[model samples]
Target: MPSSLSGRTVLVTGATSGIGYESARQLSERGATVLVHGRTPEEARAATDRLIAAAGADAARLRPVSADFARLEDVERLAEAVVRDHPRLHALVNNAAMAAPERHTLTEDGNEIAFQVNFLAHYLLTNLLEPALTSEPGGRVVNVSSSLHRAAAIQWNDPQRIRRYSRLAAYAQSQLALTVFAADPRVTAVSVDPGICATGLLPLYGHEGMPAAEGAAHVVHLCDPSTEIVNGAYYDRSTRVAPAAAATDDRTVKRLTKLADLLVGHTA
Candidate 1:
């Protein structure tokens, strides 16, 4: 795997900590030029340094990029910077996501924080970088989704959850939307459920699961060139599985994509 990605470049969002950090480290060790993205410049730099230390002789392959997912403008800027710096991105790992916000809050863009960060921002970024992704063969887009999506439904009438809000529901809905979006055929894409990792996210809910590194393995496997995983599929760790019924609905996917485009102000 290391030799396969020796000359390739990939971006891992939310690489500042948790599963994202572990995923970045693994990819860097595999000789991939990793763009480590965080919500802040300071954290991004720190994560990049950690990855460099872990990569040893491959230190130079890691780069840092920061963008607050809560801000759509920041997401747009992040994508533009990525295209300007890396003209041909071989893969994209949309691993950045947020959950368990104590209260329902709206971002500056007027979208719910979880909805924007967990799905819409990645949606916009992937679309913006479509050209770079398709410029090379075997380009991949891995969306870090969750099994919890199976228990949630898209709030079509209240997509933002303004009428009724629950942190769990918001997070699951965002993941479901992402799974639906990953079904698009424009690029080689897959949605992954990293299992219930004992990351910082779990503690907020009064529980813990597996280590972050263990959970990251699922993402690393998807990024592997040798994996026979099909595009537009959902996986629980390394096993392909059916996602929520809504996620498999063609009509739902289209509706979600249309709403996402409107939210991100993307014409297409």
Candidate 2:
């Protein structure tokens, strides 16, 4: 691991607010070029401006990137743009996500809204950006997963939850899938449950949570080259622990990868 992030480039998705935003700020403060991703171009630019103004981040080190995760095409375009512009991306923080709506909803891409936005889109985006990802020792992917994943199971045949729907279940399933994705051999990656930070998704945790910056700290810690990590590891804040059994199963990783590829209309 490098002693400093100087010259390293990192992309943080869903960076417009909360932990994602804080993570971007912290990364920029550490001297990495931070690609701040948001759902829209306006939001992306505004986030960069906020980082500059509020966090004292170098404006030159922050670049705005946008794509709506609800739309696979948007994720594809976002991936293409990043790969073209930053071919040596040192790390990718899969931090963008959404709470499942109270009512069951499907994205235009025909998958459960939360599943598409939280998991599948990231699945597609990470794979698409493979060409851009750095192969250096410290280069890796950090999945901002959730503790709730332990209680969820992927509905293999009905991932869309069309027949029975519970917002909590839908969201948990997505998180579980993301955790499982960390085990993929194609990328060096790890997943972390940021300890229930107070954010838009706090309601799902059923209690008061810590500040978003604290959670972002856990995420930024993993992004630091000084931190030693193994692929497929799961962490609860700064401590590493076991993830759900399914998340570590090789068969499960392969299955989820296939399912995600199919869901996002990607081959392999």
Candidate 3:
């Protein structure tokens, strides 16, 4: 099979399972040096093995970076690794996500579980990896967002959702926040929905879904040279679409940067 990203280095978060896992596998098979990031070391190692086995000796290009998205320090560490090790990152598939389908819980950073893991963690990581991202032309950030974001409110006053909570509601908040952050001018950000993939992940949320590999197709498509759009935008199943008016607002973007800065130990 031909690799769309031949000669590139791609990093995918939450790459040990489901959609993220599949993306990394496909990328590695095609010739990109794939970095497989998962929340745990042992699991990340297994994921690396899977990719290597799938891609054969050529898959030796895969690297596993274990990180816990529940903490900011871990995210900072991921940034450092990407910056120090990879001179040029052709693509960043910011695909790690958590549903947080239970009652309220806080991460080590004191942020809500869904907010911290799904959006904020990737937010901080992306900021830290900018030097590598812009090192060459056609560098892209494919942020995996959701159609569920259509119903989310950008709780600016209390993003942690500490005062109130609903599993799906908070989950949607994180997705919407991702959409907004992707609109920033610093990089080419494209948020996309892979549809509902049938995977071990859905049982965690009590939902039935579609095939995981099929769900991963949009991400695979977005990373290709023939994708219809070329700048910061949104896509769902290969079609270009607007995320939301609020998702692209400057004030909200500024607000998101402020929150992310606080988490990353920087001044917004």
Candidate 4:
């Protein structure tokens, strides 16, 4: 791990708000070049400006990128742009996520909205950007997973939950898949439950929570080269912890990868 982040480059998804936004700001201030992702180009640019104005972040260190996670095509385009421009990406903070809606809604891509946005989209994007994610020792992926995953199970036969739907269940399933993804051998990655934070997903947690920065700190910690990490490991804040039993199961990771590839129309 390098003592300084000056030469590193990190891409943070969902950087318009919450923990994602704070993570981008903190990383930029630490001297790392950050690609701030949002759902739209306007939103991405606005977030970049806000970081400069409010956090005194260096404008030169922030790059704005956009993609609507609900659309797999958009994710592919986003990956193409990143791989073409940043050939040696140092880290990827897979922080973009959305709660399942009250009703079972499906995207035009024909998958549950939350499932596509929260997990499948990242799954596709990461695979597409493989050429860019550096193979260097400190390079890795950080999945902003949730503790709620402990209570959820992957509805394998009906991943979209077409017959039965619970917003909380849907959200939890997505988080669980993300945790399981860290175990993927294709990439060196780790998942973390940033703790309950007062972000857009706070309602799912059932109470007021800590500031977003506090949660972002846990995420940013893992991004630092100084922090040692084990691929497939899960964390509760700064502590290494076991996640749901299924999250570490080899069969689960392989199964989820196959399912995600099918859902997203991806080959690998």
2 or 3, which is superior by TM-score? 2
lDDT of all predictions, in order shown?
A: 0.86, 0.93, 0.81, 0.92
In angstroms, the error of model 1 at 56 is 3.7
Candidates arranged by lDDT, highest first: 2, 4, 1, 3
Q: By TM-score, is 1 or 3 better? A: 1
What is the alpha-carbon lDDT of model 4 when measured against the actual structure? 0.92
At residue 189, what lDDT does model 3 achieve? Answer: 73
**lDDT (10s digit) by residue, model 1, range 1-268:** 2335688889999998889999998888778899999999899998888776654626688889999999889999999999999989988999888884879999899898999998999999999888889987888999998877888888988998999999999988888888998887778899998888887778534576888898888898888777766778999888898888787787887898889988889976
The whole-model C-alpha lDDT of candidate 2 against the native structure comes to: 0.93
230 in model 2: Cα distance from truth in Å? 0.8
Error of 1 at 10 (Å): 0.8
Tens-digit lDDT track for model 2 on 1-268? 4256889899999999999999999899889999999999999999999999988999999999999999999999999899889988889999999999999999898999999999998899899887777555567899999999999999999999999999999999999999999999887899999987889989999679989999999999998878898999999999999999999999999899889888888996
Q: For candidate 4, what is the TM-score? A: 0.98
Model 1 residue runs over 4 Å out of place are: 1-3, 54-57, 204-206
On residues 153-174, what C-alpha lDDT tens digit does candidate 4 reach at each position? 9999999999999999999999
Per-residue alpha-carbon lDDT of model 3 for 1-268, expressed as tens digits? 5445677888999998899888887777666788899898888888998777764626468888878999888888888988899979878888998877688998877889888888988888887888999998778889998888888897878888888888888988988988888887788878888877876557544578877677777887777655554555878767887777888788888888887788657553
Candidate 4 Cα outliers beyond 4 Å, as residue runs: 1-3
Residue 247 error for model 4, in Å? 0.8
- Which residue pairs show collisions in model 3? 198-210
